[model samples]
Target: MHNAINESYLGERYSEWSLDSDSTIETPNKNQAPWGLENISPIFRAYENSIWQNHVAAMWSHLEARYNITSNDSCGTHVHISLIEGYSLSALKRICQSIIYFEPAFEAILPRARLGNEYARSNWLDNPNFGYKRLSRRESMVVIEKCTSVRELVLLTPTTISSLGGISSISLKPLKEPLNFVVVQQARLSAMSLYKISKIPATVGGLKWFIEAAQLPQQPGLFDTRYINLLLDSVGPKLTREPKPMGKLSPDKLRKLQTKKDEDKRKNVMLAKISQPPYWG
Candidate 1:
């Protein structure tokens, strides 16, 4: 599968390289990706929102070192946003409404065929469940609790992800704090659209795993350092929860911060002194 991808279509690999996988899917309860070697298809699968965008960037560093990126029907991103507790399907519906409302911007960036594939069929998206009719929090939860799995998420068209697993996945937003899941999902949809880079031509010798990746255009610079950093900086905040600021430090605490910086500098200098020269250069 890897060798079959066209280098011409995907672009070129332009950086130092090594194979190190950092991609993480913290969403809990996702049908455990076939773990045994039998079902184990060699493919890079990552699920990260804005909070952990840096992990995505870091993972890119490893991939760009090897293959170009290909964004096609088979290789698209599915955003799994965690919902706040006591949330209603209405919240999710509003998000669907927004996606349908602002379809043009997203349409321009996504591959034409992706909108109709099994994973993201446009016809299925036209369901009445995700319509403007608001489901009460109780009503929504009832439907949600009865199901489990991304497949069941089909009912919530445009917003394809149903529910996932994690404390980060499990931790619900504070009840009283007003949060707009629509805004969050809309933001995620926009980010996904931007990242849906469609084609690349490339060549390689061997192929194994994720046959679908070979079906369309490839992304050569998918792991470009500059591109990765830019992507993370742009959307990292939106995806992750903001950490509360440890209130202002006392004079003693300020001194400790200074001490910490000094310790870090000393350790870094020592490490550099012991390090070997660059291998690739």
Candidate 2:
């Protein structure tokens, strides 16, 4: 199948979506409110819009109850983008190389506090000077996977990652979601794991997949249940849930402000170190 880049699609590194309990919004939108995952501590799912949407709130509430989520389950958003015919493996490699070429820009922007600790600290690389480059390696992992006879690139990791890390975390497969690393609930984790797998019937929404194997054993009333196992549901997109772009800051303005903030922080830290005395007086 021929695939091309949808100009509308954005390649951006967005901020961590804040989860507010007393959110007055009624619906979920793309920018005013975008959905994100935060299963770790303070386990609560917040709405992404000024108004709450039908499916999102109810669905997340159901999940929260069934899964005993805790603070430890917290995870940073690791977006995965599928590379189709237009964006083949070779294209991804070029992107990776570009990031490596502009490694300083990445290091200049990403705060040090976000790196080197434990949870998400440090890229696959450990050194601050070069470790930042690892961030670009994540996207390099995107590769083509064939399910049945269909073939496509399954992108589950960032366009950049550490040198050692492979496809970031989730184990990509044709029939199922990547192997889940976030343990929302130990006992119920097995069931939650199915959410990411393409084999299960998609429930919530976003983009999803459905199998049409005419050859699979069909159970027409009299026959037993064989196709039931094949039923799978993945998340798909909902226009109603997205926020309108009526009121928003310009992207260029936002980038400039964010850059200044980050740069100022780095500058202050450097000056402080130079002025402060050594521990051994």
Candidate 3:
């Protein structure tokens, strides 16, 4: 059951990348390169939001083709490479790394919660239900302790943990001070979105593994499926077959571009007004 759950999670991860990549190609003008300064445009309202947008763009660009090539699915969802037989270990590691890098703000919130626990602090500990097996009690405790506060810890822990083994029981102790409800809510929402975006690249990485594992012939499958599709779907029909050499923009064309930019700015301002967060006293 535990393995199955993990597999399901990985599959979802892949699916997210698939969707994100599809969205990017379908919205190329909005799909700026990862870490690109263009993210500061009015379309992305905040730094974190911009980061999430770009991460999704990058991730989708990475994974789309790989999965399409393998064309494998577990259940109804596309079978992410991480869930493919024999691909879990490395896939898990890569997924972890991507989460850390692209979602640092969310990552920053976890260690704060773990510091309040006693059992989590101890050096020597046993999984009592598992017959006293040595556990990474200290390491786990350290991770928790390093968290800045309780809110951070809550954000870090998985939403659910299911045991495939014998009966599992756990206890929770109240924090000295509960996390700020509003802040917690915002952080949770942002973290959830970030997690969603990070899944794209990880899914692509997983698909790459699957292709290799299956000993399929190397070709343009990865780019052809994910990136090209994204570009075609989003950017509309390819306007030209041959690459045109760069040329200076004529004054008339430049003026038209500037006008479009100004219009975009006005539209964004209006949208922002409509979507402004509610205020309360």
Candidate 4:
């Protein structure tokens, strides 16, 4: 299948497709990769396009035309959203609240196969970790609404275990929405944790070390540029770059102005630091 895909019209792009052990998709060929996992799942790398017609739709059409592909109970689609500005805390809280309120409506439209599926378990289900079963509708709203931080929100949400025995705080599977709450919620949790810890320097470089220290799950693909888990990490480096000037200013004048601004900012910071009440030993 690897050779077949690479030699096709879209072969160049097909190079990214690799076999995944987790995939349950049946394949005729039993030829195993060096790792000894079954060569059934030909997973595509994460891709983004401004226009869906040009990229994903075209690829799907090409594959369907050339290959004798058939869908079964195991086959389902997942759509990942990569926000340009990333998600704000208030937005995430509101989203969770909406999902909680309208989950029944969402389940009503989905195929029977998706329901009770281990991959994407409904967050509203009864779990010992979260006692949502006994709560009234208004009480449930209060529970999620009262969550002050990402960590609090995550604690309130339910989690699923992966087939590989890993705790999937964020399940990759979503029926139509394809939304993974755990990934975003966890990322925000880490960011908030970093902010609270005075020992960890408040910078992008400090995040990796802090994650290691905190013993947070460090899945290989989960923290990549494609995932929202690194949204905060990705933005930190970009913030250091100088902004493009919109107003008229000569290069020399701009340099002098920047220097003056920097000095003033430093002075203000120092003054603020000194203004803090002295701690009693």
Judging by lDDT against the true structure, name the best candidate: 4
How do the candidates rank by TM-score, highest first?
4, 1, 2, 3
- lDDT (Cα, tens digit) per residue for candidate 2, span 130-206: 33343322232222111122122222223233322222322122112211121111111122112233233222221
Cα-lDDT of candidate 2: 0.27
Sort the predicted structures by lDDT, highest score first: 4, 1, 2, 3
| lDDT score, candidate 4, position 208 | 37
- Give the distance in Å from residue 92's predicted Cα in candidate 3 to where it truly belongs: 1.0
Per-prediction TM-score to the true structure, in the order listed = 0.30, 0.23, 0.17, 0.43
Which residue ranges in model 2 land beyond 4 Å of their true spot? 1-59, 65-68, 72-74, 86-90, 101-114, 117-281
Error of 4 at 118 (Å): 0.7
Q: After superposition, how far is residue 280 of candidate 4 from its true place, in Å?
A: 57
lDDT tens per residue, model 1, 1-281: 12211112122222222222111212233445321110011222222222233434554565558754333223324333333252354444333333333332233333444432223322112234522344532344345445554345445442333322111121221122212222334232232221131121111101111112223223232212333222223332223221112234568656654664454343322133223232211
lDDT tens per residue, model 3, 1-281: 01211012222221122111211011224545331111111112222112323443454355454533221111011100111133232232232222322222221221333221221211122223111343342333334335554455444332111111000111112211211122211222233222344343323233233223334222231212233123223322212111111134568555654664554444333233224331111
- Cα lDDT tens digits, model 4, 62-170, are 5568855444454444433334356665666555543433344334333455444443454444333333366643356567667788776666664422121112222
lDDT, candidates in the order shown: 0.29, 0.27, 0.26, 0.38
- TM-score for predicted model 4 compared with the true structure: 0.43
lDDT of 3 at 59: 42
